[model samples]
Target chain A: MKGLLPRLIKRILGGIVMILVVASFTFFLIHLIPGNPVEAKLMQLETAGVTPLRAQIEVQAMYGFLPHQPLDIQYIHYIWQILHLNLGQSITYAGVSVTHLLLEAMPWTVITVTSGIIVSFVVGILTGVIIAVYRDRGISNALTLFSTFLHGIPQLILALLLAFLFTTIWPIFPFGSPYDAVLTPGFTLPFIGSLIWHAVLPVAAYAISSYGGWALTMKSSVISVLGDDFILASELRGLKPRIRIGYIARNAILPLFTTLTLSIGFMFGGSVFIEEIFDYRGLGYMLITAVGNLDYPLMAGSFLIITVAVIVANIIADFVYTAIDPRIRT
Target chain B: MSAKLTDRSQQDFGLSPEVACQVRDLNVTYRVDGRELSALREVSLDIRQGQITAVIGESGSGKSTLALALMNAVSSPGRIASGRVTYRGLGEVTGMRGEELRRIRGKAISMVFQASQNSMNPLTRIGAQLLDLARSHDLPNPRAVLREAGDLASRMSLDADRVLTSYQHQLSGGMRQRVGIIFGLVLKPEILLMDEPTTALDVLSQSSVLEIVRSIQRERQLTTVLITHDMGVVAELADRVVVLYAGRVVEEASTAELLRHPRHPYTRSLIQAIPRLTGDPGDAKALEGQPPSLASVPNQGCVFRERCPYRMDVCETILPSFRFDGDGEHRFACHYEEARHD
Candidate 1:
């Protein structure tokens, strides 16, 4: 325990440094965008037929972008507001705290993405195992072809297609939005069910696109491992077919575990386009809204969350490697 | 435990009272690129209880095919086309599956192949793999079984705990082969098929493994069918030798009799091919040419006719019937058996 303390401290410090670096990078990149919050607000007021000069002055004071302010002073003020966790008030959503708005929408995003990943992995692995065991059979060939077709379609296109088929044409599912407004402002089973129902098209769209790659990877791994001598030896030992399959598949599937972990990390970044297509109030949707309104704090917060998720996922994968393979531990 | 086993031990090293395995007119063919290649042709041999029968042949002579046929594990594009592998002592009591032919496999019979390094699971501890085999066969008291397995490991001159706890990659090739042998023996199968079992081991390891196998065969009364291209192993271990050439058994006799007076020219050439400790002073005689390609082999006549030094018009036209040389158990499939004797 005493020996571990230093390593643990180093890891924590490293993690903090990574978070800060990512946050700063995101802040600077978004800052480099052509328009500012004050300019966008002024443009909005002008479009609303307010006096352009007064509106511009009001927006400048609101954002501390008045004439004669030094760039260094403005940067200091921006950092101070960030340190205090005060994402400036949104121009679009009047009087809404960026942090509160994100927090409210975060759970929906987590539920959809997490559940989608879990479902896809399980389905993909099982299908891959079956395909590998019965390779070259009609079922395997058919599934491979179908999955390839599904994987070839872009996620946004798939989302829209599913929405069209399941929502507009068939009217079987809720087209857009998580909840039906009647049970809003409080958590309820019905509200959650409706949310899940609405999320199905988007989740399926993502799952269908990703499952093919996972299945192909897993099938290839299993095929290669089955060719290994140990699998044949296991058969010679007179192990039952099921037990033999399990042993071979377990060893074969180890590398896939690492890939799965990495995929989880990447899923955070990937969810943006899918979320935008569905117009779901998730982190991706929140980030998009913030970008449109030039809400830097919310954008930075979302970027930070995703970056941290990716790093943590990679660490978890490393730990899992040691856990699964004793050779790695030594 | 049985009178047959005890009586067999009391007698000279010979086939035991009961027959363990019989392969009659066995044929195996492999289809490659729309061509049928006959791997084994009318190869018949018997393994008596508590005896080691060696099938000696060169590469592509169908020795491995015969071994796989016994195990019923010939891979894709290769299959047993004819013949029934009959087991005398092993029956329904072994709990072999119906259609799967698992009846003889692992319970009644088991096999160890040539490549030992590739034969054990690298990820799993040897003990766990052993336990898996034991429990799968419904063996009782797995912990006790595992303990006995450790004891068996020790008998093989391996560290019991180290071998049991170690993964496959941790052990040397010979150690893994010993484990494989022990695994086969632990099941107490009636017949053990060994396809070049010691082919991959070092010379020292080979002799040690052979000794272990001989000892275990004696103690457990296991009938073993060994396939090897090595004449030295055949001379040392086999009670009877079946010489296969072009998938057909050209000669079959008691080891002493066959080595003393090999009738078929193929068998004679095979024995001559073995490097002598005392250098051969006689005419340098070795069989020329590779075994005929199985796919393009002619449908009629003796398969060895093309390569036989004593080839005559009759040899190319007709397949020789297996003829006894007045010794009831000694048989040779050669037209000139009598002529050669003269």
Candidate 2:
């Protein structure tokens, strides 16, 4: 296990490098967009009768630098600010810290997206194992076909279809917003129930859309595991059904853990349409809004947060991978 | 159908050592693309108790198939088409399944696979897997099983603690193979089936492993069935040798008798094919062509006549059944007379 220490440190270093590349790439790509969002903000403020000098100061202060400055200098300053954990201020929302805004939205996205992914992954893996074990049986074939079919449907369609079924046909769970807006944001059962109530469709959409791949990956993994000499050896040794199955599962499940942990990291940003369809005010909602308004700080902050989360998750996947497969210890 | 043949071979071969396991009229076939390819045809043989019986053949001769048939464990794609394999006390093993079959498998009869190096679950330690095997058979006191495994590993010249703790990949080819033997013997099984146990190892490792198997079988008096293509291994370890050709037993006798007087043309060629250290190099006749493929094996005729030099018109017209000769324990299937030799 001590072999993991150097490998862990190496993975973490690699992840940090990936984050840096993603951050810089996002920075330049945002600036490449035509028309300055800062000037637009300045014009809007001027129309609202703010003094011209005050507007200039407001643009500089919120943007951290004027757009006309040397691009390389602006890049260095931006990187420096990032190094100190400063994401500047939101251009769309005057005087709002971009980090604070993103932090507020993170929990909602995490609640829905993480729950959806976990539910899909767990259920899908179990289904895959079942299908693989009963591969010769009719039930196994039917489930495999059904799961692959479900897997083909896009997330947007899944969300819409679920929304239609729940909102019109069933009309049980609430459709829009994370919870009943009037319910104060607290830990009370009613508020929490309403929160869960709103997420059902979105979660269903994410889970249904992604679960098939997990099931297929798991099925193939389990099948390959079943074919290994060790599994047959276990059977030949006359290990009981329970013990044999345990060995199959232990080996089969190792490859899935990295994918599981990595997905956990990526889903923190949530998916755009599902969040938008529900108007859940999660990170994806903020992301779509930022792009629509050309809000540089919000967009940049969102991208950086997602990049960091994924990189951290990737490092975790390496740790999890090494923990299970002894062959990969070094 | 083949019981009469076994009895004839028994009478021909004088020794009356106890029969440890009996395989009668065993025909195993593999289906590929809807074609039934025969792997073993009416293969019958008796494994003597407290002795090593070597089943010898080339690849595709179904020597391994016979080993699997003894346990009624022929893998899928290949099935025991029709056969009766009976252990001494277990009655008909072919009739056993599920818990009873499983209980008899590792407890009464254990097998060492062809690639014993790759036969272990790589994730678990050897010690843990040994315990798992113990628990599966409901062997009481799991710790005792671990202790026994450690002892067996030590007996095989493996460092007990290091071997038990190391994963399969951590062990060398020779060490992992010894661990495989440990798993087989840890149950203290009555019958041990080793399927080409040394095929996957290097030459040095092969000799070492064969030595271990020899020492172990002698120490425990374990009734062992050794499936191999190498006659050298048979010479080194086996007490009795059975020659198989195209999925049928072509010859059977004590190791010394068979080597001295091989009656079957295929057996004689096989014996002559071995390169000798002292004799002239040109005298060693190589086995021409190959053993018959499953589908290519003729349904009616001598199986080895195509590659056999002493071929006659009768061999193609009628399959030669087992024929007795001097010292009743020695028997062979051939249309040729016993006077034939290199």
Per TM-score, the best of the predicted structures is 2
Question: Once superposed on the true structure, which residue ranges of model 2 sit more than 4 Å away at CA?
Answer: A3-10, A43-53, A68-73, A261-270, B1-17, B279-282, B338-342
For B1-342, candidate 2 gives per-residue lDDT tens digits of 357535533441332348877778999999999998999999888888899999999999998888778888887788999988877655677887777688778788999989888889889988888888998988779899989998888777789999888899898887887788788888889899999988777778788878877887889999999998888888889999999999999999999988988778888888887878787989988888977788899988889888877788888888887887776788888886533431
Model 2 earns a TM-score of 0.92
Question: lDDT values of the candidates?
Answer: 0.75, 0.83
RMSD of 2: 4.7
What is the overall TM-score of model 1 with all chains considered together? Answer: 0.84
TM-score to true structure, per model: 0.84, 0.92
Candidate 2 per-residue lDDT, tens place, A100-157, comes to 8988887777788878988998899999999998999999999999999998987788
What lDDT score is found at residue A248 in candidate 2?
91
